[model samples]
Target: MRPDLCLENAGRRYGLRGPWVLRGVDLTVAPGRLVRVEGANGTGKSTLLRLLAGIDAPSEGRITGRPRTAYVPERFPPALPFTAVGYLTHLGTVHGLSRTAAARAAGEWLERLGAAAYADTPMARLSKGSSQKVAVAQALLAEPELLVLDEAWTGLDTDARAELERAVAERTAAGGSVVFVDHDPRRLAGLPDTTYAVRDGSLVPCDVAGPLPSGPHVTVEAQGPPDGRLPDDVRRTAASAEETGPGRYRLTVPAPHSDLLLRALLTSRPPWHVVRVAPRPDAPGSSR
Candidate 1:
């Protein structure tokens, strides 16, 4: 049986006479897998993602298994007239949700990504980071079967970026496929099920079993009132927290998850103040 998405010797180029940007690519995207694409600038990464998201057609060869997909491009046009929430609602409907359902999902995603307060703000008025949040929310409003992220984390706050990481994890956990390209080499650390490098206009398999760190862990210290609380999502990671002083507390989280924890502390309704984020005492190179 064919995988959820397959490209057999697929290739693409611009107008008839344009030089080929991507060629002779064979890829199979299975269900519930995390695929990462890596390459330098102007090397066809965006072209490959666009083709996978069905935004562009391949000039040659065949692609099968068109799953319902959502794509977040590297750049988001923020001049649209719709309010952030309204825009997301519109996209949700386009993705097949009912009007009421779409609106609710929009609110939910906006809240999750820390953009709820700007829900009513016009897209043109939102700051770059806020606009990026809206762009991400729109793609996630309908729970697409395939999620393609092209540097989608750019311009997002630390917390929002971590929220996106969680969303990616959720999508794959629910039996969906995810493909992404991020500038950070440690973006997801050692999690992708497969990694492919775009080389010479073709796709090449990368070593998924590379010796990357398991999960760089960090310790954070923050200060807040006695009654302050952390975000609910922080519990997902094996994080530990405790009050160390009259108004100071400490949290130990996996490095990748630290952003979420810190965001929770700093963005809380009362807003805890972070003191420091350092590698755990026992972590590699920490003692030296």
Candidate 2:
């Protein structure tokens, strides 16, 4: 069967005489899969995403099997003259929804992203994080067959970031395709079906250590008094743990149950002081 999207020897560059940002790249996105793209600065990651999202045309090669796609750029323009909900509603209509439906979805998304209070606020008046919520909401309003996110999580708060993760999972579960780029090595952790790294102007395959433990996960590192001990329950269900320093330890816990684990540690007779809670990184992957 044909893939949902395909890039055959795709290449892109700027001005007639400019150097190629990307060239001779080939890739495919099948239905229901999540793909992650990684690269260092100036490796054409954003350019590639723009090409896939149909925001920019490739200067050479060919792209085929274009699906209805939505993209969230790394930087969103929040100065548009419209209220938060109004802007999203307009974008939804542009994506083909009825006005009423668009308005409804706009409100729904804003609520989901914890931005409902700003629904009536003018876009220009929203804060960076609030604007990012609108950016994410606009892309998801249409339920496009292909979703492309370029550092879409940059300004989202913890809950909003987690909500976006759930949205990605929902899209793939409904048989759509998603591709994203984020600086966090653990962004979405071990969930992607395939990963590609942009290097030296070409796309190269990369290996992820493995799928994340069968549920949402987080790696929590903590430091406590020399005599404090983690609750036995925490150690029992934790995927792994290790002593990082004299009184520091890192523990991996299921995200849904993280609060319980955290509470256990903090409520212990001699509580363990939490240091950091971050998404767990997939095992080291080979990158060319």
C-alpha root-mean-square deviation, each candidate: 9.4, 10.8
**Candidate 1 least-lDDT 10 residues:** 230-239
Candidate 1, residue 103: lDDT: 99
Local accuracy of candidate 2 as per-residue lDDT tens digits, 173-227: 5568899999998777665778999999999989876534454567888887775
TM-score of each: 0.76, 0.75
Best by TM-score: 1
- TM-score (C-alpha) between model 2 and the true structure: 0.75
lDDT by residue for model 1 over 100-211, one digit each (tens)? Answer: 9999999999999999999999999999999999989989988888999999999999899988988886676556889999999988756677899999899999976643
Clashing pairs for model 1 are none
What are the clash counts of all predictions, listed in order? Answer: 0, 0
